[model samples]
Target: MSSPEQWTRPEPGAGPAATAAQPSPEQVIAGLRATAEGGAELTQLLTPEGERQPSRFDPYLADIDDAALRGLYRDMVLVRRADRECNAMQRQGQLGIWVPLLGQEAAQVGSGRALKPQDMAFPSYREHGVAYTRGVDFRELLGIFRCTDHSAWDFREHGFHPYTIVIGNQVLNATGYAMGQKFEGKVGNTDPDGKPSGTDEATIVYFGDGATSQGDVHEGFVWAAVYDAPVVFFCQNNQWAISEPTERQSRLPLYQRARGYGFPGIRVDGNDVLACLAVTRWALDECRHGNGPVLIEAFTYRMDAHTTTDDPTRYRLSDEIEVWKHKDPIERVRVHLARTGGADQEFFDQVQADADAFAAELRDYCFNMPDPPPERIFSEVYAEPSAALDAQREEYLAYLSGFADGGEQ
Candidate 1:
């Protein structure tokens, strides 16, 4: 395994002058190498045509009948509609801003569904869909973007952490949490009956392509490898990080980076829901067995703007978006369902209706979401209010009351 000490050393033949402080560029290059020495498996359970491949993690997905597959399809559709609708809401001035997961529904849903009740998740801001799957209120996510609240749900309550706005900060946090779980003896031990103990829980953290450039992410890799953290560092390599393409992030494939960290790293077709689910489940299982942390780079295309505020048309071509549209995640699942006779016309119709109804309800909720009480703003800022804050709050309230004509009375 490549340690931090190894990464900091100067290469041979770089001369004595090339000390740790001032190593030659060639020495630095030789010292820091790519991690893809050993490749990984990228399985696709349900092909675009909706066929099944044997899954080693069959226990995780064994009960997924035709109706269940249709439910998964419904999940993708509703989430996408919710995503696109939120973007449109932002455009129409309902939300302050929006992050569109337009083309990555399968990536989010597949992995999100793989999570058990005990498993924890750490997410970037774009993981609203995954949050939705975890029983987080859809409107709660809007509170952050709408500038109504800092975070919507309590982390402990949801078994999910607050959305980290900093690119890769959650990567390390997830690793640390998993490590803590291990230290607490919550992982790797068998049950009294000699059966596998379900008490041990794994963690999954989501990140984007740009996060690969952050030092925190690399440090996360280091810590996870050393301690064998039960964490899955899921990198949704959506091809572009803002205006910068994947080419600028690293020379080799992103999934291969896991080798240097002494763990398995697999690359899946992010646009393929089955592929994403199969790969993520396998990685999580390895973690549950105390054999991880794993890295997953879901290779996908970002078919929408980086955010509602961004204009992808400024930097990317129309043809590129069109190309990915043909590889639409929802379409492939529908194809698979149709091909395998898993879903008939009635099923498709019900799914469409469900998606539309959910979208409409979400739109209503977003518009009707009450603005939080003024005091709620500072409620969680401090567990116990300091003297200064108390005095300030009183003064502010008094000042506001003067303008309000004592409306409370």
Candidate 2:
């Protein structure tokens, strides 16, 4: 069993003021309300101008050198570029559909990078950024959109579960995995220096604003709390789930709802990459130490339609989109880099060339990829193919191969 130090929170109904001068839960809640109303930014590290904030979160930012920060910026830009290409490919009838993460790159990348190799991630479809961070081939992501494969990569190899399309459905799966990590005795173990080791595996699950209304998400919360599972419920509150605005989802702010489930939750400026990184690091560390599950409502916006099938113009105003343009995560980082970190024309040119080359390679791979044999479809449908399934497979293969030229002219 984990020691008492594994968890850290005020005793039941005990407020922070009793031990420290810190604000109580009610005061924290009220402060958050005031902050939201004033449209103030919720962040712990990194300023809009690319400066680091002075706080505990600063330690996380300390090791990130200028080159590393540039790399982070590059990752966000490359992911967005891939997103754009995929969207265009779908429009051109190359893909069945594409989920664009135009405005949520920072939220995904920052949180995604915070994960350790031992950690597991369960993500909703929009977490293409997370997939990239886990070393899943960027072009492999297109396989699902192209209808060529059920999932592009093996989950176990990448520490990523298959992308879940049904909103909030993967939350329970994540909680279960975290519970498994506990049962495997991965928690409460430390190295020689009395520090936690890789044996402490945590899980981070991603969902959207609309998923909060789903029964699966609520059940996930309940299970994680009951088992003390090492999981973080990462909600990217992008303000819209299809045509529905966030206002229609719930009355109270999303983060505070965690209290009802007996967990800790916080809201961060999702557009601010540094803040997302800091908050996610905190959340993951807490989970690894057994102080979980944590709920993070990343306050962000969806800059594009829900998917290729929907059009935003039908329900939203152009001015609203324009307003979010200032909060553009990529542009903000670039501005900070250029103004403070001396990101000059040469750096910009090199990054752009690299991005372009990457996109070209992805296009080539996607277009030239060979389709799986028709018979292979039913191969994994069952542990062992039943007589009826075998007969059906034979029939289909025969019918498919019966075409005058072996199904090919």
lDDT tens string, model 2, 22-51? 444454434323323314335546544556
Top model number, lDDT: 2
Superposed model 1: Cα runs more than 4 Å off: 1-42, 49-60, 398-409
Residue 155, model 1: Cα distance from true site in angstroms: 2.3
lDDT of 2 at 173: 94
lDDT of 1 by residue, 301-379 (tens): 7778898889888865565666677778899889888888888989889888888888888889988988776666556
User: Which pairs of residues collide in model 2?
Assistant: none
What's every prediction's RMSD, in angstroms? 7.1, 9.3
